[model samples]
Target: MKKISIIFILFLCISISFEAKSQSFVGLRGGINIPSVNYTNFVRGPIVTGFRNEFFIAPSFGVSYRNMQSEKIGVQIDLNYSTKGWGQLTLLETNTFITRINYLELPFYLHWQLIGKKKLKFFVDAGVYVAWALSAEQEIANDVDLVENQIIYSVEKDNRGDFGIYAGAGVSYDFSIFILQLDGNFKSGFANILPVNPFIKENPPISTNQVPSVQLSVLFPISKD
Candidate 1:
């Protein structure tokens, strides 16, 4: 599955290059991610109590490609490396446990132009994404003092593959030769990242990932619109 995704991305890149002289835009994007985990059917063990969920700041960057189907409608695809995870704060916010996971994500969007036909435009997009986890780590820290601090690397039980939905709205400006766009988006995973343990199948835990992000991109026209 991972191989197939990689191949598809490559194919898109090639197609974009070949279609450079058309009504298409390709660009680079960078953003900040606020990632968290939602837990359902959680077993409230002793350690789970008194821990509050928190968000962590992470980085996301990628290549974005768009093909304008019409003046008001288009299609977009992005290949990005996104850092995502959630943090748990102990009672009184004295200590914190932050789990970090990094993934390669591909998202396809239906793009819409809500306003403006000239320099500045308002737009919206909705899509779905597939991601493969590349790595995972955990950081433990003491908020009150500097006594306990450690980092652990583990992926033994993590379910790496994730699929999710994404939606965003933003504004863009045309520079004659290139376009600048700013987008704010939210993504929510449908797949459970916490795999069910066979031994504990009767009472398994469930967790899903979500991220909210703001991105800026500079798109150069392959061919003039």
Candidate 2:
């Protein structure tokens, strides 16, 4: 099954590239990643209470290839490394709990250029992504001193293969050579990161990871005609 999928993807890419002519680009994207969860109830320690989920921004970077099928339509594909996790900060700000998970992700987006002028262009994209977990770690700190007053543990059992949806909108600037694009996007996981019945006792009952990001990308024309 995996071999067939790989072959199909390669064939699709070759077919698209064969027709792109001078209407293709290679790009790099770098940005902030805010990982979140969908569930409201999660417990930890001796205190069985809801997790106070907080913003835990991380770095995201990717390389992309895109071929414009028309003035207003294109397909963008990316291979990237991204960070996803959630953190908790209490009212006192003394104690903290954080989970850090990293993944190598591949995403495909259907790109639409809405207002393509000379200097600036507007666009929107929607797509899906597949991600494989690289690492998962959990940390708990009792004091903000950062003097290693914490408990660190690895996730015992995890749903490593993640499937998700992504959507975003932004504008790009044309430098007459390479285009620089800035955008805000969201990636939401449909599957839980934890097993339906986690093996570990401390693990969250249910968690759906969601990432919101602000991205900056630069695209270099493949073969300008």
Candidate 3:
């Protein structure tokens, strides 16, 4: 976690230093995410037998700094508050389980302009990110059982730090003052959030988060002067 923080800070410093020479923009972005977890190499417990895992809807918002090095090339960094998780449902038992994990994330991207040069343009970006877990919660609700609905917070099963790679494509319209951007992005985490599983004796279950999102941003240009 310390190393991740250091790297992010260093990137911010470097980006700020280039702001004087390059074309830069500061922006606010917000989005909706469809998040899911992939669990593999696991020994399924009795509690998991009847449930099917599905994607959960979540929110993502952030501030971004972008520096354009040239007409077709740029770099961007974002600081975001994001949520990711999965949902499980069992129809016969009328039971549902949902997990929500909050994270503070820093992502850096290299952007490539694909089409157009003036007011309207199409672009693509590929990036890597580091994130720290803020909190995690799970909810349990059942209609068939007499037990009351419950919400539980657990850190025992969570890995506090995560890293991932992502890619995106979007269109941007420059209004001479502020740029309005719309993008679709997909993220795939490499770190297994659930690092320990008692059910599997030889190997631990690999559980990673996958999220796809649509985002909108409004950016104001920064003057070199």
Candidate 4:
């Protein structure tokens, strides 16, 4: 009877140790993002519409901390850099107008794992983003002159930056030392600092806007078992 009790206690200790090891993980992630922006003023007419229909790719980097509560659920926090933009076009009888807005953004999201076991895990994330308009540039081309005029727009009071909400879903594959993730996310702005035309008393004719983005990241774990 004494021997049996000692063996049982030893087995319990081993189980607890294994459980603690599986509870925590830390990793680093870096990826490329293909981003698209939707603007409020995009209308088809004499003026070219939509915030620059062109799609651009940017680089992203992030760090993640995850705590697993059970086999099927976990909590994760990630800090990442995201880039977005849009363009505008104006067609004049004599000249054509093009305007572009670029942003460098920082986002924080809460991650939830939908399926936590096995080599593949699926998850969803939601969060907020604070973005700064890093730069704005414009170009004008004259039909008759055969010359293009280039100018960079300067932001004043109206360029107070932008705030928005973001949500996304992704899947991740775990390897011994690294992990791979693929995700898609969208953001919607609640406020705006639209540019003003002298003829219009109210600036930023459009109020709300949206941006959609897709990302692929390679993550490396900092902690080793």
Please estimate how well model 4 matches the true structure, expressed as its whole-model Cα lDDT. Answer: 0.56
Report the C-alpha lDDT of model 2 over 10-73, residue by residue, as the tens digit.
Answer: 6556646655434889999999998877655544556654556667778889999988876777
- Top candidate on lDDT is 1
Tell me the TM-score of each prediction against the true structure.
0.80, 0.78, 0.80, 0.60
On residues 112-183, what C-alpha lDDT tens digit does candidate 4 reach at each position?
Answer: 678767779898876666677766655554443433221224555446477677688999888867778888
lDDT of each: 0.76, 0.76, 0.76, 0.56
lDDT, candidate 3, 1-225, per-residue tens: 446545755764565465444688999999998987765433343333223565668999999998887677778889999998777665444677778988898888777888987999999987678888898887666553533222222566547787877789999999999999999998888887765657553223556778899999999998644
Pairs of colliding residues, candidate 1: none
Candidate 4: Cα lDDT at 153: 42
Worst 10 residues of 2 by lDDT: 147-156
